[model samples]
Target: MVEERADAGLYGPDSVTWRIHGNQSMALAGFRALSLQAVHPLVMAGFNDNTVWFDDMWGRLQRTGDWVATVTYGTTAEAEKAGRVLRRIHAALPPGVEPESGLPYRVDDPELLRWVHVTETESFLSTYRRCGGILRPGEGDQYVDEMRASAELVGLERHTVPASEADIEDYYAYVRPQLRVSQVARRNTLKFMLPPMPRWVRLGTPARPAWAGMVGLGLAMLPPWARRLYGLPGLPTTDLLATANGYAVRRVLSTVPLVITSNPAYGRALRRTRGPVAA
Candidate 1:
């Protein structure tokens, strides 16, 4: 655990991922990117550090009483602007690599495009909403319309139509591979290396033996108050500090053992060395 934390701190900057979406008009792009870089130094200085830049922001938002900050949008205007920026960025991505099977994804591929739309929009909106933004009181429909429009702006469409099941399916298939890649990598990585994980790796809660199997039957047998009582123990509010601190500890531990190796680039440079010349 100690070594993991040390390695994490050592490599923090290269690994942090909280980059601001690029936009010429918004100074936020530069600031956000730098802030992402800054986290590593802070980690080295013994401050709490997040594994990722976005994770850092998410943690901050959650601490500020907006647990859903990642998925809710507060104002339509903000959402629109953000959506536009994302569209431009996506337009600029290089066409994706082809898989061994030869299927390929272009930046504008419907499935890939739509998933980006939904994800970024959802992330910004969730944070906004958690911080007290919502669909305009009487303009809920307008908000939905704007969201759909934004989705379309990014080249996302249903089977070449404005709306239809075929289009949706086409879009889903395109993005489904991306989702599978993300989910599988996440699950497999965790499970594969799980044995080495320390005991404090946030198992969350140990369910009582009775609740472990046949959920419907077990829950049905419990009185309503008992069920509620059981749930209360798992609520985030109760053990907030402990959970937060434990998470910090585990994150630090997970990256430890400073197995520093010379950079591959250094090796390349050495190959060009011709008998140590003048200092």
Candidate 2:
């Protein structure tokens, strides 16, 4: 992980986002980093043929080619406060690079792409621990089995059982270098773990996407022993701080009150003019 952030330019987008959001306060900065990390994947994962929540925000932009950004930073009020920083980050973009630009907003930009990668790893790990394997689809035990299977496929035995700090360091040394992540980038980004939303993060029981169903089927079909044998190599101890940090954010979000909003008065005016004929 230390080698992932060797270059100073690695944090360009993160710094820009933090600066735009006015995350001068470490607390806000820390929270913004985590929130953005979470948002990054939720958006991109949607576009793939395998994930459900394909970048709804980006997909809309693709259709209209208009800049209509939705700033949802945190699940709770405190996370919301940190989310303001992320809003500032999005709002501060220069011309020709607006969120509505025709290009794949999330993937086309290098800086934004980096953030997405970081968010995926951090968020998955964070959510995995927080849910106790229940939040994810399929049986709780299946998740570990799948991870072990994937690790084994990669030729790594570290995931066969709980890992030691030395094992984690070794894994990082071998894997981090291959990922080509600059040391500086890893240092800044990996120092903190983004927490999960404290409460059950429900989005009104929306329908699952077609692709997600397929991925779910694929996982379910794998034999239990086959999945368990697939190793996800890593020392449990090394992940302690990261795991704790994310839960801490979740804990903080849990304390804040839920926010409620309504349509503007102009909405009523528009509705009256349209006429409410058929329902």
Candidate 3:
């Protein structure tokens, strides 16, 4: 087992990112981020060509989740190791042409990396706030500033990544003209947000409602602009409904036992904060 190193990671317990990332509401944010990411042709092309997500969605989720957990809560050494592994994988991706624009695509392209970092960070923070995670004045800016360190681990230049909440919005405005819902984006949105049920789950009526509810909730959490790009409702009421539903789900999840909701890295971080486990 990796040794727990309290306050030895990138952000430590006091960072705004640590608190927001530890909340269960981040799962919803993660889905929103993926949806937003799919709208970028280069990002989607790279993902389609480079990943095995189509064949093993759960495996991809697990692997990505593990990386995020480690970087967010693990010791400094563990986070560094995870970063090195990711950098190696990115470096080795074969150059490919984006099908939509015929533009060359490289996994390690700094611009592309910055896009992913900004979109993901914005989504995570947005979701955290929407779900009632409180933030102090300037904490949102601090969260973005702190996340730049993690972005650097994956080949993004610290300067290229936004370092404040205002900067994040500015970056999004600058990039908005470049985003569109291509066929890849539409296909991926459907696959990820409303995946086909397995035979067992399909045969069982009881599971279907719950699955649909979750899918609807995820779709509802998407930004209005993203929804508009995908031809979804972009009305204010739509956002209100999504927010209300998200809060309800967050409330329910808050009741889950920590052992069930907390992944290993988060659990370790919690223990560290609490000053070690009792015998």
Write down the TM-score of every candidate.
Answer: 0.29, 0.26, 0.91
Candidate 1 residue lDDT tens string, 1-279:
122111111111221111111111111112211222111221111111212323354354333222111112112343345546656765675554333234445554564444444433333332222222334453322333334544554456533432332343454455433322222222322232222323454354443322222132222222222223224233345334333433343344336542332223222222333233333
- lDDT: which candidate is best? 3
Summed backbone clashes in each candidate are 16, 24, 0
**Better candidate by TM-score, 1 or 2:** 1
Error of 2 at 38 (Å): 15
Q: Candidate 3 on 194-219: residue-level lDDT in tens?
A: 55668787786656666557666766
Residue pairs with colliding backbones in model 3 are none
- TM accuracy, model 2: 0.26
Off by over 4 Å in 3: 1-7, 196-198, 205-209, 273-279
Q: What is the C-alpha RMSD of each candidate to the true structure, in Å?
A: 20.1, 21.3, 3.5
Best by TM-score: 3
Residue 187 lDDT, candidate 1, scale 0-100: 33
* Candidate 3's TM-score: 0.91
Per-model lDDT: 0.31, 0.30, 0.83
Decreasing lDDT order of the candidates: 3, 1, 2
lDDT score for candidate 3 against the true structure: 0.83
